[model samples]
Target chain A: MLVNQFLILGAVLFCIGVYGVLARKNAVMVLMSIELILNSVNINLLAFDLMNGGLEGSVFALYIIGIAAAEVGVGLAMVLLIYRNKKSIALDELSEMKG
Target chain B: MLASDIVVAQNVAFGIIAAVMVLFALRVVSSSNVVHAALSLVMVMAGAAALYILLAAEFVAVTQVLVYIGAVMVLFLFGVMLTRAKLGRDADLNNKNWAAGIPVALLLLGVMVYVLIDGLGDDKLDVTSGTAASTAAISDLIFSPYILPFWALSFVLLAAVIGAIVLARKD
Candidate 1:
């Protein structure tokens, strides 16, 4: 019933996810953290939407879902390409962006 | 506490899910293997979806499960497998990461809390009314005012699929 509780939870999740993104070196792990952050946003959207009695928030969250899917699509492709060329997926290794 | 039962329940639920999310995130950072990290992230996302359901956004909750847990987690799993990456490359969860990472995240948390508490300090955000009409109103807005964006989002999904396939396709 309290929107702030949900929002705070979302903020905590997003922060944790951010830490994962910044601290972890594996590109794959970074992608997973990115998923966490996005889901955190979705939680906020849905909570706010519920309080407002509107579909717009859930609807926006739906768009976010689409965006997340698309992100993974391209992200996984990039990871695969990087893996094929570099034989690795560690973030430390791919500074030059070639192969 | 007695006066705020719903709020208390919501807080407890949020606490549990937040802990789970953070724990899985820790697992993600600490695990060396890409596959393990991917699996751990599934728990994080699923916990987030559960939070959505707690908020009574039933549609969003289902979408979270279907879109994220069902589809996206698998994408991560397969991506890790396809890359043929080694496991356990980053098993260290020491204070160095905490020293650099925790402060920044904590700072962000502080900022968000201040903004939320300050923004809604005195105003009451009623959650009791509009229980029954929520679904109907949401459907109406989706079909009418927000239709274009709704369809555009689908296109976004399609484009991402094509782009990913193109990127990963073997020569």
Candidate 2:
């Protein structure tokens, strides 16, 4: 398998994720998009690990997974708090910090 | 089996998995219902795990399934339910200027694909060259050179758990 195939797959997924982040008004959807982005990065890392023959890339991928879990936990908590305050999770309505 | 046959088989598997992943990823972004989108994300995660196995990272593949599909997706579903999002379709799930995101995403994709193909043209992966990294080898590396980062990650997890509890708790 040519490495380009995997790399291009990563790029495609990453761009889709970016679009989701930009276009989704719902906070949870945005968080899901971020997961797509992270997973794409993980794919790229493991692909390179295969090409170069080392465990380093997999190590980083594992670290990324761990951090992503923590991130999602905190992110969902924030979303819950926002929903509690505003009764909505729309991203565009979040203008409290606007100055 | 011949080495060339193995490569051919790998390519075929990669093609099928990549196609399915891309489709599920598109659904993840475009699905109207929050729960449907989350379920689509689960498919994408499973597809990624399969691809990880194809790349000979069995450990990461298992971790992907266990952490992403097993734990993270469940959390996402809980977030969906707790946020009181409509279980069915929601019309306002997307931004009003969602069209603008398309061009931006396309531009980024173009640049990335061009760079990847240009920089690493047809570089074949030696899939048949090496054995899969043993779980023990991965653990050794993690405990040896990567021990510091591992410790830091633990702290991050600890902080996240406490912070989440604090943030989500009722007064």
Candidate 3:
């Protein structure tokens, strides 16, 4: 398989994720978009790892997965708190800090 | 031509999986229902694990399945339920400026695709080059030269746990 295939796929996913982050209103949707971006980065890393014949990219990918897990935990917790306080998860209503 | 045949097969598999993943990713961003979008994200994650396997990163692929699909997705669903989001389609799930995101995403895609294709050309992945890293090798690297990052990651995980509890508690 050509490396371009994987790289292009990653680029496409990353672009979709960027759109998600910018356009989505719900906090959970934004978090899911971030996952898309992270997965795209992981794909790029593993593709380069395969090309270079090294395990570094794999290790980094693992760390990324770990960090993503932690991020999801804290992100969901924050979203839960926001929902609890405001009775909604819409990002537009989160203007308490928009002074 | 046996080697070429193998490459051809791999290419086909990659194409199919990529297509499915892209479709699910689109749904993840475009779906109006919160639960539907989260479920689509799960599909995308599973597809990503398939791609990782194709790249010969079996350990990472399994970890992706276990962590992202298994744990993170559950957390997302829990958040959705706990938030009491609408179970049906939501008409205003997007912001008023949502139309602006299209051009931005398109421009970024154009730049990234141009750079990748221009720089990499037709570089093929040498799958049969015996460069696949075994699980033991990955662990070895993690515990040896990459030990610092491993420790840091553990600390980060711990902090996240405590922080989550503190933030979500009903104090």
Best by TM-score: 2
**Candidates in descending lDDT order:** 2, 3, 1
Winner by lDDT = 2
Question: Candidate 3 A-chain TM?
Answer: 0.97
Per-model DockQ against the true two-chain complex: 0.60, 0.89, 0.88
- Which tens-of-lDDT digit does each residue in B30-94 have in candidate 2? 99999999999999999999999988999999999999999999999999999999989899999
Taking all chains together, each candidate's TM-score versus the true structure is 0.86, 0.97, 0.97
lDDT of 1 at B124: 39
Question: lDDT tens digits, residues A1-99, model 2?
Answer: 688889999999999999999999999999999999999999999999989999999999999999999999999999999999999999999998993
Candidate 3 per-residue C-alpha lDDT over B1-171 given as tens digits, one digit per residue, 9 for 90 to 100: 354536767778888999999999999999999999999999999999999988999999999999999999999999989998899999888999998999999999999999999999988787656455799999999999999999999999999999999999998
- In CAPRI terms, model 2 is classed as high
Q: Which ten residues in a row have the lowest lDDT in candidate 1 chain A?
A: A46-55
- For DockQ, candidate 2 versus 3, the one ahead is 2
The residue pairs that clash in candidate 3, if any, are: none
